[model samples]
Target: MNKQNVTVNDLVQAATKFRDDRDWRQFHNPKDLAISLSLEASELLENFQWKDSAKSMEENEENIYEELADVLIYSLMLSDVLDVDLNEIVLNKLEKNARKYPVEKARGTEKKYTEL
Candidate 1:
């Protein structure tokens, strides 16, 4: 499959197939999946630890992307197991954030909505 053409659903299907093919669903309870997701996120963060942004980006680009893909794949697996629509959930959260942080107040500001 072309990486550029892969979508969220495609990833979810691939993850599901991988799990099923290995009879791994028996071990993929929500809690375990969530833990894996968090662990991958920490790995992604570890790539940047003690390094400046430019250095991290330049020196560990491949590792960074690999960790990010791991995080996203685990997240998609969790979402599939939970029967959640990832894109819908993200869009809904974005809409809620837009209400909380209107462009006029949020633009060029780092403060929280209440602080603004």
Candidate 2:
């Protein structure tokens, strides 16, 4: 997606186009969308909050999916505001993290690079 010209003013236009294409606008007003995003985050947290890794791994698939979609939708709104390409940013961030998490010294721990 073209990221440079898509400003906050253009977000509604793009969002409207998306809604019109899929007939989803009835459910995507600013307030409703924000609330839905928060609720979805809570649901996602429900999967792992206060639970061991094994228990978190046992979470229901649909719950995780719904929460992820909610998060992504909000992320798209934020990306639209900043005119950023999320895919590009995410991939770059992953590469940076790989640099920080090399196996030689940073293996099997959650410490930050400074601590390592």
Candidate 3:
């Protein structure tokens, strides 16, 4: 149950095995990975078209999970391609967001970034 070890290791192992077995990593450059990740996310969003939040959240979870896996898998591959530590990048981004969205400015509303 070591969080760091399991979280990233499992993802990396699975992605690595997938790439190796398919021999697809040769084309998974950083630019393509980033584009592909965004494309997968867009496809995920397509599943919930015109659905209410509560209804969509309750139904279609399997589809959502599948799309999310696509997005996340490519994300992991992108991280691998770039030699970036996923944990570190996530932590750093969170820190920056905390500063940018202090509770005083960001609480209790869906304000746009420019508004905040």
Per-candidate TM-score against the hidden true structure: 0.93, 0.55, 0.85
- Ranking of candidates on TM-score, top first: 1, 3, 2
Per-model RMSD to reference: 1.2, 7.3, 2.7
Model 3: what TM-score? 0.85
Predicted structure 1, TM vs. truth: 0.93
How many clashes (backbone atoms < 3 Å, residues ≥3 apart in a chain or on different chains) does model 1 have?
0
TM-score of 2: 0.55
lDDT of each: 0.92, 0.70, 0.87
Which stretches in model 1 have alpha-carbon errors above 4 Å?
none
If candidate 1 were superposed on the true structure by all CA atoms, what would the RMSD be? 1.2
| Model 3: worst 10 consecutive residues (lDDT sum) | 1-10
lDDT tens readout by residue for model 3, 31-115:
9989999999998998788998678878888889999989999988988888889899999999998888888989997886578
Clashing pairs in 3: none
